[model samples]
Target chain A: MSAQTVADKVDRTDRLGIQQPRLPRLAPLGIAAGAAVLAVLIGVLGGLGSRIQWGLIAAILFVVGLYVISTVVEGGRQAKDRLATSLVWVAFLLAVVPLASLIWETVSKGIKVTDGYFLTHSMSGVVNVAPGGGVYHALMGTIEQVLIATVIATPIGLLTAVYLVEYGRGALAKAVTFFVDVMTGIPSIVAGLFVLSLWIMILDFGYSGFAGALALAILMMPVVVRSTEEMLKLVPNELREASYALGVPKWKTILKVVLPTSIGGITTGVMLAVARITGETAPVLLLVFGSPAINNNPFDGGQASLPLYIYQQWGAGTSASFDRAWAAALVLIVFVMILNLLARGIARWKAPKTGH
Target chain B: MAKRIDISGLTAYYGDFKAIEDISMAVEPRSVTAFIGPSGCGKSTFLRTINRMHEVIPGARVEGKVMLDDENLYGTGVDPVSVRRVVGMVFQRPNPFPTMSVYENVAAGLKLNGRYKKSELDDVVEKSLRGANLWNEVKDRLNRPGSGLSGGQQQRLCIARAIAVEPQVLLMDEPCSALDPISTLAIEDLIGDLKTRFTIVIVTHNMQQAARVSDRTAFFNLSAVGEPGRLIELDDTDKIFSNPSVQATEDYVSGRFG
Candidate 1:
């Protein structure tokens, strides 16, 4: 019956919602090749210096072409949908391009100096002009400083979040929330300056990795609190009520019901905050007081960190130093990538089971 | 053990706005009393006050004397948590703690009381699930998530969680409203069996459900729009259905008007 109606309405197809045949799988490829050819031709005619301009022009042309083709093949409504989908793909590619290029650049330049020997040994005695050095000491300093910052920041941020989500009611909560927002927007350099003034200037303390860690802690706390508060808010109040109805105390309910429910999100939030702070070079540069030699004591002497090492190597302006800097950049990227992967893995493992 | 409740001059408020006006009633031990009313008639509000769950909302307050077998629930120094422990509640939606396994959702309350061995918890979880008439279906998958079950089964899991700690009173706020007819019947049957063990107070919009499950029914109605809801009448379910004392009760029961 539907087929009969469809056949009868073929002339007046726009009156009803009629299904149209889809584009072939190779259609997009053909459109993309056409776009590329057009872009290259225009680039040649216009004498454009940057090859990047060609890629950008091609992307735009592809999106516009897709909508026009879809409109001619299907209808206005389907064309609009295709336009939306094409626009979304364009947006995704826009986001991915910078990251892809950055990773590609790092890998290409970093492989020159990066090896097993470079990883295990330190730059204790190697001169800036030479090639035999490792990031082991800097890696150690970065780990210790980040770990210390995490240790100091996690509890304060978590407690503040619990207060905001569970028990927040009046002026104090609003004040705390306002301050956290303000803190999040503060420059990392300002935080470093804050630690510099408070710990070094007034207290007469010398520069150390601890000072750098303190600054990073200041940078990390607000992020942790904000992210944690968001995660906590995502926990439905019904769960809290369910726990309360079961005679669970408020604190116990928070610990058992609320926290466990949002544990996956909370872990992801914390890792994101950690990732945000890991590559921060400003505070590390300001407070860490870079040293080439291995420093085991973070509290007493100057130390090395990944970002600081990268900065020093890059600033040295030598072929060898540039190689070292690129290698460190590669290591930092891989470190952050691993942290991201772990966060997602943990989130999946702890995600609440919802359905059969 | 079940306890008789005597409430006198009860009033509930959300900030400055009164929700339920001066209400009074008595509930017998080990019997089902259903509160039937139109929307915003304070049936849910009044039910929440019985266990101090009403105060969970910000600016929500109650003025009343709720005597639970001679103990004043709203009296000075009375802990709301302890009151809630004695008077457990099931909500309108089936909230079976999506984060927990079927076995864990049942054992949650018992664990809150803090002294049960794993073996004791196992026994109580099994019994509670059986009491809710969900044991046969979920017994094999007790380790699975509670949310993995069907909606009706999740509600039963919630029921099991509520009853596991053995509260004297069980308050169900439109427990079957979110369920289908078959699921509603299943819950009604479970409520029937549960009344033998504990005193049950339920708020329901469905007149037939009230008539079927409740021994006594209370009708609540608002005097006018924006006015506090008042208790119109209370009597045996049959009498309330056949011939009510109040005009509004008769009209509401007969579907003349809400």
Candidate 2:
């Protein structure tokens, strides 16, 4: 065939063969709106009381409607692709909804009572039925207890992780690995009870934040070890070999090369462990024996922590106490959020400068 | 600082598998000796054995003698760390410590040995980078991360890192295999310059590279698949390429078969 005729035939086939019918760009949004409206109508007609039930119905309808419409317009194969995409989105929203709602509820309700006055004043003289209490004593106790726990756990966890990754070889390594796994699954309350038996029952130590810190340390150690181990394993074997070939001893290589390379990840892990143990109330309740007055010395006497304070305030069953509980809960959330942000900042700061 | 290497009846094993068996050879001081072989022939394994790097692998061991000058590397009471200090190595792909700066990568070995004055470290780093022919390019950006460099520059940086400790012998395992032709040529030139100061043994698959950079060439082969690799021939590079005594060496250099 002539080249011109052949070119024309190719153009006709390209136009006919490649393109397929697709849903409009705004179709998903349109479907979601329709599903929400229909879900509300059904909820009203069926006399469903909760808006949460309406939301769940709308989500299910959105997914089902998208699949049916896409299958009709874009074929079964494209419909399946859209189905997978919508499922992932639904799963993401499912996870995000409760977290967003919790933050929203806390901020809206707690804003009334959480202010500079609430942060700076202690609840020493305030009665549970009346208002005018703050989280000052509890915040101080939480900070000191968590700090002591971090101090106790970090070095032990780091050393254990180093031993596991660098030198762990035979049955001993296997045993240690098994114990770390077991320790990771230990309940926070069990850790509290164990400390209660040892520190309070056996050692005859009085209720103190230090006792609570020991329990928090137990809960935090395995988490730190697990995370640090994963980060250490991520350091390339080639880097170790490189250090070894430099005449550096095994310990020096680990200290200078392996640890430095994974330090960012390790710090982030430790901070996450701290965040996890910060809000643990069972250990604090059993060991520290929540106090109304501020206690500066964690080693000496009873202290109040944020979680324990929240628990006590809610149990009082008064409107003013409920407000204080919500405010304390918000303060706890903000504390955890701050820790997470610090973790991210340290991770970025200490990350290996691999790129410009 | 160059030292002659005398290896006799050397055998290396990984777990229960014999990787290389009964290899014996002598590499002269201040010379470039190239190891050329097909894949899985244990050329790299044999090179690692010279510096006691083979035993770093779990359950991997070596049985034989590798003497540098008068000291036997596998002898009793000889620390592997000190042996590694005397013998430096560059890997196939560039492995500059990702967390270290270019200057720190070169100064890493020096720092491990003992405390060095900052001036001394600067001098050694600059000298080593110059020796690797990387000084002119990286001198201005010595504080930049070694990993930020291009592949060729990173390989050169690794070379500088190896030489900064002033090792008696330098071992390179296919250092140019991961580079483009231009980078390979740059390394070839650097190797030629480096042989004047250190006894260099390099493993490579490229016959042309072997001819271009080496004074002596060792050819390695195995009898069949799953068999332990052995040294087939060691001779002058020109003789190996043109008129090798072994038929297998001739076939390999001429690209007849692996």
Candidate 3:
């Protein structure tokens, strides 16, 4: 009945019967270290060329060793449980390894050429094969084009989502939903070609950042609609009913109550869409035609974006160009990272104050 | 302003299935009327028809007349939105607009009607909260989210929001069902005070609650499963509890059967 009695009863039972055994908390760590040593020795003797292979072998041996040792010390069920846990840990490391390596590779290769001078100056007179060029023009073009695309896409996407959630009915809603699904899977290159044919060839507009933006807007819209729709659906029907019972009209209820309630999620979705289109190179290459000199007016002439700049630099196939490409890639990743952080900040600031 | 309700042969349907059968009754102004019924008896559905809240659901329709004082609520040119302004409602569960502060939730209805100066809005919000017996509990935390309040407090906040607009009639569908006994008693006391200014209609599953808080009581019942719920009887609360005119009403009032 009491804590002392329960403990005495358990102690008496343990002394009278066989003891239940468990491995120490640090057992897995010790086993992992042993497995690593064994894997490295096997790799050396077997003449395996890559450390990646050694890591894979180590992960496998660790899981297998954990299962066998746990079975001997504990039981079959505990062994299976440990095996599952180790498998999940190995999978997590597998996922993390590529991402960590990518960031490491970008930082190491890009750090040499990514100074203030590289960010402030443009490649007006510099050739692609030389090492003096910068990414100033590409940064400006990406900022302008992505901003334009977001401005174009967000309202359209938001309204479409509202219609689907609030007032949609019958065949028309289904058709729109089907089309949006279809559009979400459209290849980025196909969007580029569509924009090039329509905006440039038929409309007789020259290659410009605006043309690239049109394609980016096409890609951003469906993602926004999907996420916004999901957020809207999450709003409880009771809130809407409460608003209606207070004599608020449907549109006013949606605008004042529903939209405000889900604004954080909607903003997050829009920011994610913006991030997706920011790194798009296919549309920029086909429509904007990639410029080396800075062009502030996106409507009139060709412009460069970071992704397109990276592609062009890499295509040059020179050591200097390769360095420039790596630096541009790093800059692009940092830009996206900043945007994501800003998105999170906005989400927190705008989130409904439901907690104490 | 309080207004009387006069219904005549009112029938409601959810798609092709009838929810409530043709029934008629009159509810006096400035009095509390409680509707008592078993589960699935359509008491809540009938209450929704007063403000045309019933038709808000897809394929849900109503037939016959609902007269609010001199105006027919189902008149050809009358808008449901305007009708709702005169007939506010409190739902079964407390829903206080999680995005809004307590002050904002109370002022939401007024904001919809028209623009108001800050001082005027503040006065109405205070008056409404006080009217719901919630001003003292929530006055200091007016700027906090309405959802942060206790369950009983949130329901009172919803009541404050409903009364802020000064509706003639206030319908409550089990407003105290989700609350504890103390909170239920608090709301019951508030109902006694509110009946002087608004025509109050409440649907309650608790028979003792109806006997305690209502001036008049109506009993609704269904003949069998899938049958449309029909009004069995309506009478003064004391008489209905002691000596009801209908056999079903007597059976229900005495707790012999539902």
Candidate 4:
């Protein structure tokens, strides 16, 4: 449009080439190979105790390599930022690799004995070293116990959170808050021991799934309270005042306004708490007594949960029992994964329709 | 139906610190009274006291009498819940229930009372939204979330929510302070129409908004920083704006000082 040739315009193709020297696309691959070689060499020379030590050294080397490479090519400031970014990525990978490998190992070993027969059949009369046993009783027991625990814990936890956030005042509220925080840090085994002493020793009750659930509920209540309290606190005070100003009573306002506003977060929290207690082995071991046969009634007979099944199978110390153990671990992982997926789904579905 | 509010010897405190002290005034039924003042003057706190909402805050207590027609709001046997049922409040920020639909927001207060049929609920929801002048714009999309509306429309929805319960007095605290000029004008017009059916008291930082909407004006002031705020004067909006009695009122009205 200006009626001038392209060469007549001021151009900086050469200057642009020399201005900034970016790291090559293949630089990361090179860094990975270098770190790996360096890790193995140092690990062997120092006689590291575990292979995990090699990974730690490699992670450190990658970060340092990124920082030094960036400093030489880019600048000091950019090198620091790149160093931080690489460190974070290394941290992310550090967390993910263990989790991924765990799942990978479970899947690979689990598929050998994991099938529809494995899902539906039980280990009622099978020998410990035999390979024909299944986890049907354990699955049923896990579902029932978790359901009972959720039912018992949700309302009590929710009401306590409501009190803490909505009407909490004075030293009493402070004491409750402090106790809840302390309860959160109590070990799962301690909760199991408490229920065992109170119910079996004091009341003279026999082992049952109901007794196990009581202990699971104890472990779960503090989690539910802490999470629900946070969620309820997130509801804006204006919504409550709006309902209050409209002449709605306090209880009605809480039911209609405060709870609904934060219901999505509350449900997610509850489900997470459910998932947490679903895999609890210590409580089930001390209370459930780990039955191999199928028992439908949770309040009467001994129960077999997935966590307890895995522990029993692993303790047998045989190759056949090892397969069952890995398969049971796989099933437990899948159970927790499904609960997490369902929780997220409910959260997205029931979340307040606020966005455009 | 609107009712007159007479407040006397009203003093409020947050723990040991006095927020407002010795404020006395009477608001006539079916009229708009505006409280005009600077920041930290306790105009918002005074409005909260009328509905017993100030006590909702921790350590917030009041020494006063708020008489609505024949009943003492702060009497020993009176329930704060019942008092709130008779006196509704709209806050400064537009806060429609984020989880509720536009129709559900209007129906929320009525549903709490729990005796209305579905048809009756529809009628009240339509009537209240109509009363708030938001019926036509939202009638087609009643099931949409209340928060999806524009700022002015959400405020009107909150107004609709307040009026759905058929309260006697409606209190507003700086209702238009967070709005744009056009939205502010819209809220001002809605306030004017709302005064015909409900006694309204508004707190505003903008003097012009007070002048435009209110029939009477009350000026609140503090003697100095960190001191309890007090009512300087209450008079007709024209007299208060055109010629205030106190020199500090004149200075504040004329933008001389905060």
Provide the TM-score for each candidate, comma-separated. Answer: 0.96, 0.97, 0.95, 0.93
Report the error of model 2 at residue B167, Å.
Answer: 0.5
**Candidates, ranked, DockQ:** 1, 2, 3, 4
Residue-level lDDT tens digits of model 2 in B1-258: 999999999999999999999999999999999999899999999999999999999999999999999899999999999999999999998998888999999999989777578878889999999999999999999999999999999999999999999999999999998999999999999999999999999999999999999999999999988899999999999999999999999998888984
lDDT digits (tens) for residues B1-258 of candidate 4: 999999999999999999999999999999999999889999999999999999888899999899999888999999887888789898999999998899999998888868578878999999999999899999999999999999999999988999888889999999988789988888899999999999999999999999999999999999888899999999999999999999989999998984
Enumerate clash totals for all models, in the order shown: 0, 0, 0, 0
- After superposition, the stretches of candidate 4 with alpha carbons farther than 4 Å from their true spots are A1-54
Query: Which regions of candidate 2 fall more than 4 Å away from where they truly are?
Result: A1-12
lDDT by residue (tens digit), candidate 3, A1-356: 99999998988789767666889999999999999999999999999999999999999999999999999999998899999999999999999999999999999999889999999988899999998989999999999999999999999999999999999989999999999999999999999999999989999999999999999999999999999999999999999899999999999999999999999999999999999999999999999998889999999899999999999999999999999999999999999999999999999998988756
Each candidate's B-chain TM-score, in sequence, is: 0.98, 0.98, 0.98, 0.98
Is candidate 3 or 4 superior in DockQ? 3
Best by DockQ: 1
Report the lDDT tens digits of candidate 1 across residue range B166-253: 9999999999999999999999999999999999999999999999999999999998878999999999999999999988999999
What TM-score does model 1 achieve against the real structure?
0.96
User: How much is the lDDT of residue A305 in candidate 3?
Assistant: 97
Clashing pairs in 3: none
lDDT of each: 0.92, 0.95, 0.95, 0.91
TM-score of 3: 0.95
Question: Compared with the true structure, what per-residue lDDT tens digits does model 3 show for residues B1-258?
Answer: 899999999999999999999989999999999999889989999999999999989899999999998899999999999999999999999999988999999999999767577779999999999999999998998999999999999999999999999999999999999999999999999999999999999999999999999999999999988999999999999999999999889998888883
All DockQ scores: 0.80, 0.80, 0.76, 0.69
Candidate 4, residues A1-356, lDDT tens digits: the string is 46464544434355445456678878866887899899999999999978899998998998899889889988898788888888888889989999889889999998788889889978999987887889899999999999999999999999999999998988999999999999999899999999999999999998999999999998899899999999999999888888888777888889988998888899899999999999899999999998989998999979999999999999998999999999988889999999999989988888999748
Stretch of 10 with least lDDT, candidate 1 chain B: B110-119
